[model samples]
Target: MYNDKVMKSALESMMFVWGEPLKVKDAAEVLDADKKVVKDLFLDLQREYAMMGRGIRIREVDGAFQFVTHAENEIFIEKLCTPVKVKKLSQAALEVLAIIAYRQPVTKGEIDSIRGIKSERVIDGLMSKDLVDVAGRSEGVGRPLLYKTTGEFLKKFGFASIKDLPDITEFDDIEEYDEETPHEQLSINFEGDADSEDK
Candidate 1:
């Protein structure tokens, strides 16, 4: 049986390799331990990082966890290395993403109707960026594919889970909006070596 110290150490190493949020259930299965114990251990690790004010911190999103730099150290990190620039998401992309995020497992038809425009290109872009993905096929007329936000969404938005989305009034008043690309840009800075491919 893995002792608490050993289990925690193993979990830390696993999280570092996982890069993405490590699911408690997956970790428990690998370690042959109960999920509850693993979850508590993950929580303990999270608390320890916070208490120690470590430069690299663990963040729990939903039931999974991942390592993210401390927001407090953003300036120092940027000064130390050139930050990778992720292409700024367009307004249309933002609108489509919002719709998909709010009404996840939503159909393409539903998204188009809500936006009053076709979002094929925008959805494709979101998919390529790993923000949205196909959840499954709808049982409707043509059995259209269902789209939903992924774990990357939670990490980028700093949300613990989808349930953390704040209360917002419906977009029922959205009668007809032009699909024009606005000058507004939402900059997202991700930590990594700058790649020319991203440009």
Candidate 2:
């Protein structure tokens, strides 16, 4: 049996790890507790986070709970986001990004076949930068996750939307877009790291 304190800790951990809103009933199922109890505990957490005067707070939206930055911190958040450079793509990350942008809801396996190398790391980097997201899981044998460029990708690439991408007919071949020189390098100012390798 979960005590109130333990259940509160578990709820907070789940919300943080998920990084998204979770339904009360869903939290209850994961916690193996009563829904009413989970709801009450979550409410208590909401009040506690509010009183802490921290940069983050938990909020309920449409009956789901998520941790969000406090409204008072929006200015600082925007300032931080504003400094992110636009042209930091490495040759490998660029190739993988292009593939995701064009061939999305594509799976890792498909990307590997197209590029002829394992791209798990490059994909991870893109995800860390918030450019790529899991669109869904494929119905294939392994149910691998499908990747897609996020709205941030559109903003960075100066595309009004995915439909604004250059027409497919414009490129003689999709693979050709992935054929940049292996040694080509680009670095982002914010991340201060060496250019990504094509490995």
Candidate 3:
């Protein structure tokens, strides 16, 4: 008794329960359905929600899916909810974020090279903020984990995709980080309150 309608309904409930982006494979496994079938159904639901202009919409981040409010309805939601204090990002964090955004799927070693400092803490902070995540393992050297920006990054930056990022002259003559002590782990600690105009 495989029913598209029932499965879709179940999927919606599942997404509601899974607050974070739910991976397609997980949904497929739960439904005992083929991965492609589940994915197509998810796409179908996405279109239906948009076509009908629903207040709640499904958003795909990376390969996972989650429910999100319609962008146009943000004002109303903002007014309804109490304004929560936002966490601040240090200058060091911002610098590391920029490097990762521009040269994504990059390793910590490569990031250290571009910024001339260890970025372990900054990267961890970005991961906590849901701005970036590990993409996969690289083949070079010790097969380090590759990092890339997340969909939340796009939502925060108001970019449809990474390709929309403004072009800039790439960093020149970047040095390779030496394993022992590549640029002492210096941290730029500067935290400033956000202006009223900024998001």
Candidate 4:
């Protein structure tokens, strides 16, 4: 009873509705058709799209499938898409981000040691920006709060996961151009303009 044309139409409908990814089995179940039939339909559609000079194509990642623009046409697609400018994070914020990226699920105290200063304000700012989140509590003394990057961070940085972060074996390799420091090192600027205004 599974009409191939009807099944292909149903798969397209599912893709439009999902807007994320549609696995072959999931799409088949939604359309009440055989998985193999859905797979064949998908392959046919993919070939047809390529032949017809479509801007988009279907891709499978892990076990999930989704529609994406052709890599070769990305520049043209981007021009058509809305341009989003990301705000440049401050040095303190970037330091905090780097620490969380490398030593994830780390506590504020640990971050303070790595950067040699208190990071409560910077951490709060990152949290407010939705770049980081409370991962969990450490199983150490006082059970301090631990922080980790969120999916928003990955999306902003164009990473699918934190595992995609570049490796940093030596601390010296990290950027050392914080303006608040005397020699552009990682020294804390507790008496900066903001603190001076408060006094």
- What is candidate 4's lDDT per residue for 34-97, written digit by digit as tens? 7787787888887877788777665443334556566566556558769655355787887888
Worst 10 residues of 4 by lDDT: 190-199
What tens-digit string does per-residue lDDT give for candidate 1 at 38-105? 99999999899889978777777877987788776666766887756656677788878878876889
The total of clashing pairs for model 1 equals 0
Residue ranges of candidate 2 with Cα displaced over 4 Å: 1-87, 170-172, 175-199
TM-score of every candidate relative to the true structure? 0.82, 0.46, 0.66, 0.55
lDDT of 3 by residue, 80-107 (tens): 8797665656767776877777778899
Scored against the true structure, residue 65 in model 4 reaches a CA lDDT of: 50
Clash list (residue pairs), candidate 4:
none
In order of listing, the candidates' clash counts read 0, 0, 0, 0
Model 4 vs. true fold: TM: 0.55
Q: For model 1, name the residue pairs that clash.
A: none
Count backbone overlaps in model 4.
Answer: 0
Which residue pairs clash within candidate 2? none
Which one is best on TM-score?
1
Two-way TM-score contest, 2 vs 4, winner = 4
Query: After superposition on all CA atoms, what RMSD does each candidate show versus the true structure?
Result: 5.4, 11.4, 8.4, 11.0
Residues 17-102, model 2: lDDT tens digits: 98656789999999899999999998899899889887777766446676777656755765766554534678789778877876
